[model samples]
Target chain A: MELLEEKIRKEGQVKGEGILKVDSFLNHQLDVALFEEMGKAFAKRFAGEGVNKILTIESSGIAIATSTARYFDYCPVVFGKKYVSLNLDQEIYSSDVYSYTKQQAYKIMVSKKYLDKDDRILIIDDFLANGKAVEALIDMVNQAGATLVGVGIAIEKGFQDGGALLREQGIALESLAIVDAMSEEEGVIFRAQSEKK
Target chain B: MELLEEKIRKEGQVKGEGILKVDSFLNHQLDVALFEEMGKAFAKRFAGEGVNKILTIESSGIAIATSTARYFDYCPVVFGKKYVSLNLDQEIYSSDVYSYTKQQAYKIMVSKKYLDKDDRILIIDDFLANGKAVEALIDMVNQAGATLVGVGIAIEKGFQDGGALLREQGIALESLAIVDAMSEEEGVIFRAQSEKK
Candidate 1:
């Protein structure tokens, strides 16, 4: 976690309207080495929770989830695809997600064949801003009658309500770096979670 | 490669209309152990090419590219984002890709900050059907004056023109499993390759 926090401080850029630009390392351009570190952290946090599968919404979440799956006995990572492809299964569990970053609502889907009542799912994502995407993934897990082990995130906008809401629901959510506040001029302020709980 | 081919034969479903759905283990639901094998194979193929970076498009490609990046000396993996985001850099190298799967022509953008002339990029993708997305990513690499060491594809539709065209261009294209034909009745037929050539 310290390494991630340090990397964010060094490369992440704070922008207006609570936006953090991490394309240089995290978002558009990924650091695979850092992803492995994050994977180890998630494995430690979610250890012994019967996590048989890793679930994430597509685009950004796939890399982190896939990397993290290696630590969980190489569990299958089922991503919620945003677009309907011919390759996707017809029988699926779908949910709507409202994106605060994109300012648009889209559907996230996972094939029913992947998730079942016997599976334990760990929801992972790159950023948890409004928590809409995570909520949708959780909804899909519920619809599939699977166990919701917990959620793992790389960066959590602490100022946002998503992390708070998940924690309020008694979900064991772990974010490697929580940005308490970020400004272009003031830099980034990460929440001190050493005393969490 | 034998393991991958076996996975496709076992879990991969052949639907009507020229579609082979391997969502059970490849794209939608990913197997991290299998991905590691793929990473090792790609590393072996692109070895000594000085592949400094792994380039890929978003969604399905992100997970594989991230997995493959680990085997390449933990190289940085930069994925081309399909949609415009608020945090994206204003300066970008963009290309148009017409997705026959989605039936939409979307722009793929990579931040100009990540890629440079000195970088040796290896493009990785989940599938190489018509090669539109891979071609667009190659174009983006050219736009940035970066060197494309080769293209690593998980599955290539050998019946399609994408694989043929890239091979004809003298590109070092390596596909783990190339399906020549498949049908609901006739089953899957793979184009035999010279042992890991």
Candidate 2:
């Protein structure tokens, strides 16, 4: 987590409206080495969770989920597709998610064939802001009757209530770096270290 | 490649409209071990190409590209975003692509900061039907003045013209398994071994 925080401080850019951009290494252009390290940290945190599958929403989440899946006994990673594709199964557990970033409500789906009641799923994603995306994933898990073991994120907007709300719900959420505050004038600020109950 | 071919022959479903669904292991629900095998095969086929980066489109391509990047001297993996986010840089290389599967036209963009003229990029993707996705990626590479070393695909529809056109242009294209022809009735049939040029 220290390395991720350092990387963010070194390469992350703070834009208007408090968005921290780490595209140089985190999302657009990826550093596999850094992702592997993050994967190790995730494995360490959820070592005894009995996670059988890793679930993520498409685009940015796929790489991190795949990397983390390697450490979790090479668990199969199932990504929720934002758009309907010819290859996707028709029978699916679908949910609606409003993207504050995109300014639209889109559908996220997973084939009913992949997830089941017996599976322990770990949800992973790039950013946890308003938590709409993570909540959508959790909703899909619930519909499938699968148990959500935990949620893993690369960066969490601690200033927002998304992470806090999840922890209050007794959901195990582990974010590698949590940004409590950020501003063009004031710079970025991460939350103080505290173990989540 | 044998492992991949075997996986397809086993779990791959033959659906109507000439579609072969292997989402259980390839794209939607990803098998990390299988992706590792694919990465190794790609490294073998594209050996000596001086590939410094793995270039791919977002969502489906991210997982395979990230896995393949590890086999290429830990080169950085860059994914084109289907939708621009607030976190994206202003400067970008953009290309329009028509998706036959989704039946829509969309723009894919890569930050100008990630790719350079001197970089040798290897394009990785899950499937190649009409080759529109790979062509769009090649266009992005060209726009950035980067050299496209080759393309590595999990499955190529040999019946389609995409693979043929690329090879005709003297581009090195390697598909783990090329389906020469397939039918809902007769199932999937890969191209003859002699056709593997």
Name the best candidate (by lDDT). 2
Worst 10 residues of 2 chain A by lDDT: A188-197
Per-residue CA lDDT of model 1 for B124-144, tens digit only, reads 998999999999999999999
Cα lDDT of model 2 by residue, A1-197, tens digit:
89999999888989887678888888899998899899999999999989999999988898999999999999999999997887787899999999877788999999999999999999999999999999999999999999999999999998888998899999999999999889887777887667433
Model 1: per-residue lDDT, tens digit, A40-155? 99999989898999999878888889889888989889989996786677899999988878888889898898899999999999999889999999999999999999999999
Most accurate candidate by DockQ: 1
Per-residue lDDT value at A56 in model 1: 91
Tens digit per residue, CA lDDT, model 2, B2-112: 888889888888887768899999889999888988999999998898999999988788899999988998899999998777667879999999987888999999999
Model 2, global lDDT: 0.90
Stretches off by above 4 angstroms in model 2 are A195-197, B192-194
DockQ of 1: 0.86
Candidates' C-alpha lDDT = 0.90, 0.90
Error of 1 at A46 (Å): 1.4
